[model samples]
Target: MDTKPIAYTMSEKENPAITVHVVKKSVTPNVPSGNDSSNVTPTTPVAPTPSTPTGETIKQPAKPTIPNYAAKKGAAVYATRALYLYKNENFKNSQRLVKYPKAKRVNRPMFVVTDYARSTNGVLHYKVRDVNHGSKTAGKVGYITADSKFVVPVYYQSMPKNKKIIIINKKGVNAYKDANLTKRVKNYKKGTRLTVKKIVKHNLASRYQLSNGDYMTANKKLIVQGDYQIINY
Candidate 1:
């Protein structure tokens, strides 16, 4: 029983075996060059076109036209109401030459129209030479209103069909034997009727030739075309 102990040795073919694992890797494809139609790229967005402006342009008003019935050149006119003489047709206050007060019908201030003009406001004006005898403003030239209410033609401008005229001036008018009115013949009282032969023009003023060969002023303020019942003034 003492001889049972014995030595033992292991061989290489009797050892346990070990196992190992291996991993696989992936590869990517290269891009084509030089204007390839198959290749795509990012694009930028486009903006919309703008519309044209539609604002309207403002315009100024047209000037007024002159009337056919307006007073003519080389005619006589007289003021019926107070008025101002202007240096220019603009009729501005700064352009005023003088202020004339309203006068009596028989002694109203008179003027001889030299030209016609229109103010900026479209009002018509008469360019005239003052002919008020003995007035300090006589012979002065200026512009005045052409309104019928403020100014009017001194003469009727046409012969009456009856060929008769009557004195209407309160102070009456003088009859002159000469056209220049230098020689005084007589002074006819108001409401006196006289037959007219014809009309005569002297120094841009009109005179009526009487059948008696005497001359009287044809001023509308002093004479009327038709005869009426005489009334004592």
Candidate 2:
């Protein structure tokens, strides 16, 4: 399911890498609905009250009101890699600027091109890596969207290629096969999208990271591929 992640900025020194920032935090109110719980003192279970006429003691009744909104306790933290932004890109916070230097779409200088591909209608796709949003100088991670009329201006002159992400653990592979592992969904660092190229059949176990520092094969199948850009920056 497509979910909206909390957006924030990182320091300028954190580009092309995993960056995290604290967003908004809220607290839930604890208005008591039952007997006097809010004002209840641990020393005494029954609340004390003043004496009424004829020396009769009167206990105060609990007051109930609208409770404050709070997210459920123990909420999970959502994090993801930062991505590029473009003008009118249908992203959450899309903006336009015409000053960014135009770089024609090609294999990114950082990530090596691999054999994986995807296509939409007739246009091909490729995976983009080390994407940044806003100014890389700002060191902020954000989201933006772009259309075919891209801001960075990616020309489909040649077929695109790039590396893909994978979870690298033999136990993770075995757990994935048995459905015993939990989910690992993360936000796309906002405004992240990729272009499509032809896909290679299998991952070939080329990239693997060890959980206990032991390497595992990465035979994961290819699903999608594309270069990423902010449209018409």
Candidate 3:
């Protein structure tokens, strides 16, 4: 019996050198004429053949796509107060702007400026990267009129040290996952004094970026801000 490997090749119209191995079955050795049939050893079964390939073969996985809003590390910035974000430098019209988060009524939008340019009219336009916000437009980058009245360029003067804050709000206030008051992290009882590291303002509310880097809200009217010094500019 023959004992050679069977080769599978494409038709003449297809690849000529490309060959694949299918079955490699070995022929049973011829039994001696005097040997009994019961003494013959059983042959191993052949593996099933592979299915014919149809679609274009893929060798590697597709690369993960980078999102348009992917955060790029740059000069750190902070918003002096809440402000509006526009699609272009011409914000006076309001028609040329992207929709801001209206349902949450977040008037004071805050973010870090990523890029800046001057319009023909000598207006300064800044590409601000929105920090976490309560609206669907959160984490977006857009141009805004940086007239100093709104956006203020700030730097890290020093690492914030621990400071004590008292919750004067008789009702209570909420802790948040982000500086924006969109997500509630926890709730604090009235008179609940907390030792927070830093104080900041984002979207109309004063937020505490804690020593552990967690954030919580301090409503302007509810929590007293005069006592706690704003350290991080």
Candidate 4:
């Protein structure tokens, strides 16, 4: 056991270096859970309804009918009360041509109808000529109301039960031997009273057979049935 120090040494073949390799992993985003209410599906929309109308409807008035006994064209008409003659059927105050006053039956103002017209309000009117002899308004043409209360036929159409008839025409009527009124035999003055036996028809007109077998025109403008008292207004 001798006391001595010694050094050690190693070759490249006996020592080797070690090498390390690093690998990385990718990260993913967070997602909602299946139990969350934010994952619900959308619903469809609805449409609104329309409103109804509530107003009332209006109607127009109907026209009135004329009476069969009413005076017609070419007939004489006289006013029972004061009446105004109008330039047109409208009968406005501004269109008034003259005012006719009611008078005694024998001298009452008269008019001869030429035609008929209806107002916008369905009132009836007569187109006529003022035929009162010697009147300042004579021969004037105009329109007047056809209201029976204000105006009426100058003569009567129906026969009276007593068979009495009077001449009403301003001019006298003539008696004939035949119903045709061809042979004029005698003339009866206005206001003359006569009795009729019967009525005869010829040429679309009527004639009255006198008690003496004479025939006279039964024209409504010429004669009236019954005895009427003299009236003054």
Candidate 5:
């Protein structure tokens, strides 16, 4: 049972604000007794003035936004033998560099790395051979810098053509016919053993060629690359 009127006013200023106010008015008539009619004075009621109506506020246009390319210039995870260049960095008066695409389910790109160096700004730079697009820079060594946040320096190891052993440290690893792990040939459970016939590495990860001719990922997370002995289950 509410009978109060709700009122609101909008400011006409450039940056207008909305305000709301609620008001209630009540008046009661005073009745005098017949014996005190002469002594009682009639009081006059004050009239209320009309309030001016307010107009709606118009919204102002939003300010234009500028992108910060510096913050977007970040480091990419790279391997000693391969790395993907940042799409944001371009050669002198050249086009933006291509990003090294990764294999399916793999986290890193597939560029073959040839050399790496640190710039004066503490950025890590890698020289790699390009593929796919076959741009003018293809087959030639092109330098790409990596942000420090994602750079991991690695030492190059020269191993003989002899067989090498690596241990699987993770669960549910996939073995494929190719280095890209596209056509899965088998799924290896944790504790499975693998004898590496040949170790091939690209920018994103390394692939191990088994004696049986099947290949599996040799990512740092999937296998330990040291002298850890394999135990027969």
Candidate 6:
């Protein structure tokens, strides 16, 4: 377990600044020849117009954050100063880049984001345009579906990827179901955890597939599935 407490040091000090004053005075020079010397006794210095200070206050901006999910080498990735990655057509071996990169690449590569994983401080990332690395922008996209209606359609570890998958949450609620949807089959336990892997929406009453294709009813009362974490033994 990477359970290390991130420590920080705090220090306080008075801010430093520069102070300046503009001295202004109205003095009548010796008008008469050698007669104003004794008469021109210096009066108390008058303070210039007392007013509020106004000008630009220069402040440094905070640095940009780098995400944790780095683009796979040769695999198209977003090349950001805050989120930069390597570029290569033939993606073969792996390598690592250090912070404040000494060598900089003038070329930029488009990136596709990986799902479910988090980067560094956990900033949500997205596909960097072209999903391919070899494409024009060196961005490449995955396979496309045949029937694209302008724009159409849109797991859990430990368990088999197949098994007619039904995703459940910490609450034992199945958000998805993948069971054979036919006529409603009954004579099962009441208030059991379930997944709706398969639902024949065409019919008024659909079948709700359970974790392993076992099921109940879509019209019946069932607990709603929500966010959950699986505790392994």
lDDT to native, each model? 0.82, 0.29, 0.56, 0.78, 0.51, 0.33
Q: Which residue runs does candidate 6 get wrong by more than 4 Å?
A: 1-186, 220-223, 227-233
Model 2 off-target regions past 4 Å?
1-99, 107-139, 151-198, 201-233
Best by lDDT: 1
* TM-score winner between candidates 4 and 5: 4
123-232 per-residue lDDT for model 6 (tens digits): 33332234433445343332111111211111111222232322222233332333333344443332343344444432223444554565543421122233243222
Query: How much is 205 displaced in model 3, in angstroms?
Result: 16
Would you list the rank order by TM-score, best first? Answer: 1, 4, 3, 5, 6, 2
> Each candidate's TM vs. the true structure?
0.57, 0.17, 0.34, 0.57, 0.33, 0.17
Once fitted onto the true fold, the runs of candidate 5 whose alpha carbons sit more than 4 angstroms away are 1-162, 201-204, 227-233
TM-score of 4: 0.57
**TM-score of candidate 2 against the unseen true structure:** 0.17
lDDT of 5: 0.51
Q: Put down candidate 4 lDDT per residue, 1-233, tens digits, no spaces.
A: 32343434434665764343333445566677767769756678766676555685565785556667557778778887899999999989899999988765666678888888889988888899999889899999999998989888764445679998888766878999988887889999888899998887564356789999999887555677776652221
User: For residues 1-233, could you state the per-residue lDDT of candidate 2 as single tens digits?
Assistant: 33445655455675555556545556678777669777865774687897658977777985422122211112111112223432322332334222234332222111111112222232222222223234342332222221223322211122234533332222233211111223432322222332322222222113222222222222322111233533321
lDDT of 4 at 155: 47
Q: What is the lDDT of residue 210 in candidate 1?
A: 92
**Clash pairs for candidate 5:** 75-147, 81-113, 82-113, 82-203
Candidate 5 per-residue lDDT over residues 199-233, each given as its tens digit: 77654356677889988766544454444465431
